[model samples]
Target: MPHEGEATPRISKVQDRGWAWVVLVATVLVQALTLGFPSCVGVFFKDLQYDFRASNSETSWFPSIMTAVLHAGGCESILVERFGCRVTVMLGGLLSGVGMVASAFSKSISQLYITAGFITGLGSCFSFQAGVTVLGYYFIRRRALANALASTGVSIGLTLWPLISQYLLDEMGWRNTFLIFGGVMLNCCVCGAVMRPVPDKPPGPTLKSCPEQSREGACLSNGSTSCHEEPLHPSKRAACFQTLQKYLAFDIFCKNKGYQIYTIGVSWMVIGFVLPLIYLVPYATLNGVEEHKAALLISIIGFINIFMRPMAGLLSGLSIFTGRRIYLFSMAAMLSGLSNLICAISSEYSVLVFYCIVYSVSMSVIGALIFQVLMDVVEMDRFSSALGLFTILESITILIGPPLAGLLVDLLGHYRYVFYASSFFMISAALFMGLSFCTMEAKNKLKETNKPPPETPSKGKYTEVPTELDHDRNGPPTVVYVTSI
Candidate 1:
């Protein structure tokens, strides 16, 4: 449409507004489906134990394995980069649906471990990574707010799924409940359909000099020579391998000190982070609370968590909270630890209810900002790799956390020591994170103080003066000169 000499105009796209919200909605739904069901595993604990005739620690492995695989399986981020978000998520939905259906037919604990724990967890990993990664592509300025809003889906699912799972377990037994849940999980395909990939700019031509070609064609009539333009396309198999390598890169651990500190601190924190969620219902039942009432306690935490996540997100995005989110996160972790310690000492329903409310506040604040803080520390291109490695490390804790708590319950004959252990781990993690934050700040201040000041121009060096200034002079045809030194 334009002359040969005219440069083409490229349209600039605005981010963090408009269609980005749609992507956020789809991400929320994906998270709700993936994380919500796992959070409700506690509701099925008694049913599973009764059916399998297993001990408490043995039964706890179902959720523990599922949680561990879900986190460690973040390696699925490679599939997101290679196959694209929609395909990877759709595949995940299919696997999840099939796994749930298979779990319904599971005759023993081992079968459940294979079907429910490994398959469903693997599928959830794919869907979760794709959903989380897509948000970074669509938002920049409002990234924290978007992540907060999207993460609330976890709270919503946590709140509602327990009630739904409880009703189903009450009416139709565990097997039929899993069958119906399989059908419910098929809806993840629909959510995947909504996850349209954000378009990327096409790669520009790459020029490479060819000395041999230049020498052979130096005498062209136009006196201009052609250079080779490398093709952008690669074989699909090679591309897939490259994608895997990109997401699995481990150099980030060695290159980023802040990220290293965050990873270690979070790994320690996660050892206790999920134990309370998995054991709370059982603990409540041990202390004279009814089963239904115990389930309601989780719902209460979820209800409060829903509001707290968005509030934390908005607060973290404000200027006052800028550059200080890590401190907020540390405080939240400390409060969570303190709440668990209080729970260890209390048996009254009213006291436990208050503890749940406080736990919700801390959980909301921590969950909402955890990834955002990681993004702040790592380069954007390396985020997926960083998240994958972090998840893999955290999975070690997730895998062991619940089972260890269950072991304590078995030996001590009470859940109080479990709570005490959780409180200790969380508090230690918080202190580590706080130390890392202080160290980073001190380094930044030192850098600022050591930076060299700008050099001033030397005096008595003549510089050109503007002609308009000479015309402005009215008396004695005054000649003016500017001097620097």
Candidate 2:
């Protein structure tokens, strides 16, 4: 028997199959639209450089800034949770669409930076976070597969966007390409509108105080206790406002060794991660591979990634594997690093292509699993806040990683060293994650083997509970209160 709150397979009835399919398709479509722009930047790089007359250094800033803003939007998760998914996402879509439209009118590099990188990135941040968060709540047992399926939108968008952007660039020009894509992005609003809220389990009732009741007595809600208090007075609500005195909650991120492991491993791995993808085509072209052949490499990578993500999810969910998904992910990361290292040494283009295929599979699987690991470390309720803190802290790396890779390429005058360096980073990440996996295994085993760990003193805190006999019975449920001393 599955333990309470342990994940159980929720096989849908045959009659609901059609509705499930609809949800799956709708979710995946929204993710595809949201991710298209960032994933297709490489295709636009050469054109943007030519049009703007920007140096490689400057052009790199465009994508870097865009990625930075996207991560920075993690801070908005508090708002997303408060406002509900539909409204937040629809607003994001509008913002993104407008940003694209603004980008189309840019006449200078700075203008392009502001519109394409900043504004569009902000919109994308909202859409991506909200979509992923919603997916987490909607499905439990199938979350891995659902997330994988949804994430494939990146690859699909990558596939179609590049081809479309290329055609538009040749036929109509970059400005017109942005205009058309901007119109296409307006559909994100429709996507947002379709994302219905996921239902939450009703919590047990809580009372703020029972002053007249004996300490050990249970006070029933049906007037079992007749003591009356002064009529409840409505308290003034604090007006929401933004402030600049932001502080990094380093303690939250640092206190959990698992989160530390995840953060370090991901940051280290990603530093070398995007470098290869970003430069894959250029690397091939420099090696004398034909242009079309080089482009096809990315398509092949994307296709393989499309399959690998769900496969990782499915594999991770299996009970037969001792449920050691993190360990498996560690191995995959190591292999990806090794593949890159080999590719760096290979002179034959076919060998390079083979390496690309292997790396693509590993990278995609790791990407999908990484967030799952994060969810495990931080429960769903705290996920948004943890992710926000992670983003703000990890933004430093996200901002620096690519430009540093570009610098290495410029200095070394080749990308082979980049691969070697990236491999080292990935190896370091793998080793750290392997440690985390071991510690996690030991902890879970201790928890299961009838041994009780020592207890720690509690911190006084309170949480809001939505109280209604049935979760769906009323409008938004009323907030019940609790006290901890």
- Name the candidate that leads on TM-score: 1
- Indicate the residue-level lDDT of 144 in model 1: 49
Model 1 / residue 215 / CA error / Å: 32
- RMSD over all Cα atoms, model 2: 9.9
Candidate 1 CA-lDDT value: 0.72
TM-score of each: 0.80, 0.75
lDDT (tens digit, per residue) of candidate 1 on 1-485: 23111211111142456667887888788778888778778888878988998777888888888888877754564465456667777788888888889999999988998898888888877777666666655565555456667787788888888788878888998899999888887777787777665543222223243333324322111111233333369898987676555655467677667778888999999889898888888788888988788888888888898898878877877777666777888999999999998888987789889999999999988887787677666665566567667777888888888888888888888988888999999999999998877876676566557986336311111111121223221111111110000
Best by lDDT: 1
| Per-residue lDDT over 64-158 for candidate 2, one digit per residue giving the tens place of the 0 to 100 score | 77777776654455555456666667777887889899999999888888988888878877777666655544444454456566777776765
Q: Per-residue lDDT for 437 in model 2?
A: 60
Clashing pairs in 1: 459-484, 459-485, 460-485, 461-485
